[model samples]
Target: MRATMMDELHKPYVDTARSKGLPTYKVILKYPVRHAVTPLASTIGWQLPNLVSGSAIVAIVLSLPTTGPYLLQALQGQYMYLAGTFLMMLAVLTIIGTLLSDIILALLDPRIRLS
Candidate 1:
């Protein structure tokens, strides 16, 4: 991620900022880092579900009583209602997180918009 953002920072727009007499830190922050934040924000938003699901595996290993392990158990047992509810919770969280990231990115980067 840092490498990708560094590549973005090296683009011509950052040079333009440098040529316009912007200081090194200011130029880097205002130009490239600003652009880099969008994808990072979106990635973080999408990864929320992974964090939730990953913890389930950890909970199982640690013998912790968490929803993730129980959710997995429910699915394995063919408990449709319980499984569906857990799935719905995950789906809603994912959608909401993405929506929030999109809104924030749209606000920060005028080149993109949410219709």
Candidate 2:
């Protein structure tokens, strides 16, 4: 059902819609076609490069503090790997920051994600 809905949203729709006499972008835009974008983003959140995306993965990784030198420092406390952890956290935080960015983009443009 979702795939069908998305197929209808695009122009040409894999070049098949044209053969069936479906409206292209010109006709669709003129007809004021609009759809909500939030739910789709919400659905895509799991695999996206943001906090909600793969957070489960990170959480599992972080739970084990004594794994890698990088993850070791990231836990908390002045262990011998403090520097390594700090840098590791910096990288991880930067990667996680994309979550905020995804949120901001979604907010700024309700139509950021297509139907």
RMSD of each: 2.1, 8.8
Please, what are the lDDT tens digits per residue for candidate 2 over residues 1-115? 3563465456453355456666567544332233333345444534333332234346566763333434434454556476565556556665555575567556646666456
**Model 1: per-residue Cα lDDT over 1-115, one tens digit each:** 5876879877988888899998999987777776878778777778877766668878988988778898989989999999999889889889988988888888778888744
User: Which numbered prediction scores highest in TM-score against the true structure?
Assistant: 1
Stretches off by above 4 angstroms in model 2 are 1-80
Q: After superposition, how far is residue 112 of candidate 1 from its true place, in Å?
A: 0.7
Tell me the lDDT of model 2 at 24: 69
> What TM-score, computed on C-alpha atoms, does each candidate reach?
0.81, 0.28
Off by over 4 Å in 1: none
Q: Which residue window of length 10 is worst by lDDT in model 1?
A: 45-54
Backbone clash numbers for all candidates listed: 0, 1
> Candidate 2: lDDT over CA atoms?
0.48
